[model samples]
Target chain A: MMEEHKVIVELKQIATRFGDNIVHEKLDLKILEGERVALVGGSGTGKSVLLSEIAMLREPDSGEIELFGEPITQMSGRELLAQRQKIGMMFQQGALFSSLTVLENIMLPIREHQHISGSLLKDLAMLKLRLTGLPEHAAHLYPQSLSGGMLKRAAVSRALALDPPLLLLDEPTAGLDPAGAAAFDDMLLELHAALNLTLILVTHDLDSIWTVTNQVAFLGERRVLMKQPIEKMVKDTHPVIEAYFANERAKRAIRQELI
Target chain B: MNEEKQPPVISESSDGVQLRGEWTTPYLKQLQKISKNNTRHQVNHIAIAQLDPNGSRVLLELIGNEPSAWPEGLTKEQRGLLELVREKVGPVPAQQESVNLLAALGQQVFRVIRHGRELLEFAGQLSALVFSLIRHPRQLKIKMLLDVLQRDGLNAVPIIALLAFLLGAVIAFQGGLQLATYGANIFVVELISLIMLRELAPLICAIIVAGRSGSAFAAQLATMQMNQEVLALKSLGQDPFAWLVLPKLLGLMIVMPLLTVLSMLTGIGGGMFVAMVQLDLSPVEFIQRFGAVVDPIHFWVGLIKAPVFALIIVNVGCMQGLLAKGGAEAVGHRTTRSVVQSIFLVIIVDALFSILFAQLGW
Candidate 1:
């Protein structure tokens, strides 16, 4: 079992509901500072829900979610928003507003949080855009003008505008080509190492599990399947673990190795 | 067979990944159940809104199986009484009474003499937006103008013409009917022809444009409000009122009078058709009388009121659209509200104009 006392994000029995449907049960979760945790699960297994819940878009019905020891559930809208400004989230759809220019989109959060001159704001926007490896010239173009891979990269740049300490990315490599996804993973690793940013990634990509993360949290049927380092996680015996790894695709690959 | 019954196929077909067919079967059944319920619920909702309880009960008997349609129950009744009413009313005939020789004779006279006072209202209200955009124009420039003119001018022409023509015909018909009671049918031609030129045709045309384009602008703006695109601008630290509402109001104000004039022409033209064919009136005699009936003030009066109509259309429509809530649905609601309110206001303003014009006795 992994040690859990040094927690940056701590949820003590969090419960959240949508109308009457329970999205999250009395789920207890924690992520330490600098921890690279991969939240893995089946479809509709509350992986994204838990991530967004901590992001504070949807409030928990009962129990508390703490960020850097500050209780999130108790914060007011302005305070909650201030707390959110400290955390960066790359959404599943790269939820960049469709109408804004790339530069305007990046500058939106920065200008909102800080009062600065237009030239200084432009410089800041250009720096963030360059960090994501996009051309500075692309800043003037609209979101509809970009390709899917470019969109995610642009979204990542926007998410990092205020240089938030923690980054919560949902399906970072979901729709990328293998080469693009690999490059993205490397970029993420570089950003994480450079910024000392805590990355809590939610994904189902088995390749990402082997390639990217240091630790893993398996959210299965109702509770955590295993919360440990990746190497140890594969060795552990859990039904979800067995089912995830024991697919015919793995067996077929092994059989094809003989050919 | 039992192995097949166990779902999650992951078949090695042409496609790399596949779930069992049965996996989708249950989901489909749920979808079908949902759609059926939705159809039923939508029908019911629309039925409830449009039809009397007696009529709604008759519709409920035809399609009411809840869970089979949809769960949240999409609105049912939008297809309400329109369908039933259409069935009951049968095939509508072309408007025959729209044309007559007396109306034709009257329209020729009304055109030169018309008091187009509505144009002034359009002028004052339209300039506000033009002045604002002159300071800081964006992608909103030509598109807003084209949209306003196309809707106000082009689409409104036929309806306005039809209304003017029909009004001229009605004046001739009604005046002729009364005068015939006293064996004064010849005087009916003079009375209808005189009224058509001096006041009726231009007034009717202005009213039609006011209702059509005015309400259209209101509804359009109201829908914008509902979409929250306007709110999104404010969150980005942009003023939606300056960026959206003002320019549109100005566009409508500038564009409405030209369209209103076109509507009057069409209404009078429609009247001319009736007058020429039904009243045995010559176009030459109609023009001679029309020239005699209308003075410059009569035509100017109708044109003067158009700016007011345009102003109301833009401000009111935009306000309603801006007030829209929730999402696209709210946009639709406010759109209806804007159109209804704009048309009513246009009529009220026209009525006030009538009272003022009558008081001046020009």
Candidate 2:
């Protein structure tokens, strides 16, 4: 089944660094179409940095990135922009523009990329807002006025406005309460199923990993130590992966797994 | 993924209308125009080659929200997407209510009154903190005070000197022309010294400081308020006013008089240069006349207003900052208001000082 699907993102021998501090080295991973993958690691392991690299906001120090089966280094600026329009990235802190209303924030990307007019643009933005479980009233309020959960949902709505097939999230559930996190996980799964999106999210929440992601890419030392389903990843004896999941949450998940 | 696909198109059919092609966002740009122009057909069926959520939404909008209008032969994924978008199609947000003129005027009046009240409360709280800190002076943040002094005071010297010198030169050249024509070129020294020491120096310095340090204080505190840094300091049992607001107020108070003195010296020096070059008066003669004719009372009168201007500037800046409510836009708005209000208040206070000094026969 994996072979049948196309590879959406391929990173080969990727390396990133800041001065003397090395974050990723010789990191190689392939995310297939319609797969929900999570990049999980300890702090400073550069999960967010890797997501940024994939989004083409930042270039790696070395190695090649193949986004949608084309090498990014060789693409022209216009081609890069065209390819980038197919990818939507949501930053960790709901990086919504504070000045624009939530509805306008969602409409901005679509307006820049498409030539749709006034009523159609608003209707499209409103549709995306509803799809992310945001209420109608939220569309008129500024991002600063919304609560934490609503802000995250609003950010996701803006990301989905352009209907990008690939959606990247950074810490989507980090600050949410337990119930909100669970609901967000369900929303992600539903969106993935309905929109057929290939998702790559950077997160540390084990519950979100189990509920939303089908593949877990564990970062350790300076590379992806393993890539497998969460059920299998929890059983791995690798010291880094074991140390990461040693908390009580992992134990409860394992006991409750029924496997 | 970068490959270009067929743009969405609506074709006329006997039954209704047919949407054909990849109905994705990038491709739907053209379909909007086509759909708007097609008046003859009711969109009854959508048999698109490819469909995303955006495409499904456009299709659902084209056909009214009737489930019966869902075309046949839609793949399960496509059907699920259409249903999801259609189910969530809520009414557009309501337009803002139109406010009547009398109510708006009343709101404006109430807003000004509330603003004044809040400013008074903040001023009271700040004064209470200052009084308590005086008894335990060791509690004062010496390091932050020094930092603010270096940034808001020492860093502002160059621009202040340049403006003061230019203003003095303009006054001397203009005054010397009139004084020279009357064969009283020596009185240019009295004119320059009196105005520079008593009015122009202090007023120019205060205006510059209000634009510079006042705006900075407001923007810095407003950004902190936005990021919850002020709240964090409060939660830690530390008074944000004491730590954040007091340093700026005290630093500006300490530096305003020093900057005014610098302004007076540069302005007088500029006047002295113009007198020697343009009025044919020597520096020694100009200094002698300045000391004999310009009373020492003028200098004191100007110096006495520095701290008051500082007080006005710091209070307005910190008040606007602490009251900021939103995000980046609020920070910008508050900072602009801080500068404008400080300058306005400084000029009004200066005028009041002039009247009081005249009545007192200073």
Best by lDDT: 2
Question: Looking at candidate 2, what is the lDDT of residue B336?
Answer: 98
The lowest-lDDT stretch of 10 consecutive residues in candidate 2 chain B is B38-47
Write the residue-wise lDDT of candidate 1 on B1-362 in tens digits: 01232321222345332222222211222323333344423322111212221122223333442334322222343243223322322111222356588988899678534423333333444455467568767735567567656766776767766666677677767666666578754454456544554456545654565456555655566666656666788999976665666656656667666765665565455555555665656666665655675465765776787777667667566666555554455556666766666677767877888899889996
Query: Per model, how many backbone clashes are there?
Result: 81, 0
List the pairs of residues colliding in candidate 2.
Answer: none
Which candidate gets the maximum DockQ versus the true structure?
2
Considering just the first chain, candidate 1 attains a TM-score of 0.90
Per-residue lDDT tens digits for candidate 1, residues A1-259, read 2333457788888776777777667678878877788998787678888888778776678888899778876778887776787688999878887778887898898788765546545655665676677765678777767877788888998988776768899999899888888878887886676555688899877677767888898887645667788767765678677677666346546767988
Worst 10 residues of 2 chain A by lDDT: A246-255
The docking category that best describes candidate 2 is medium
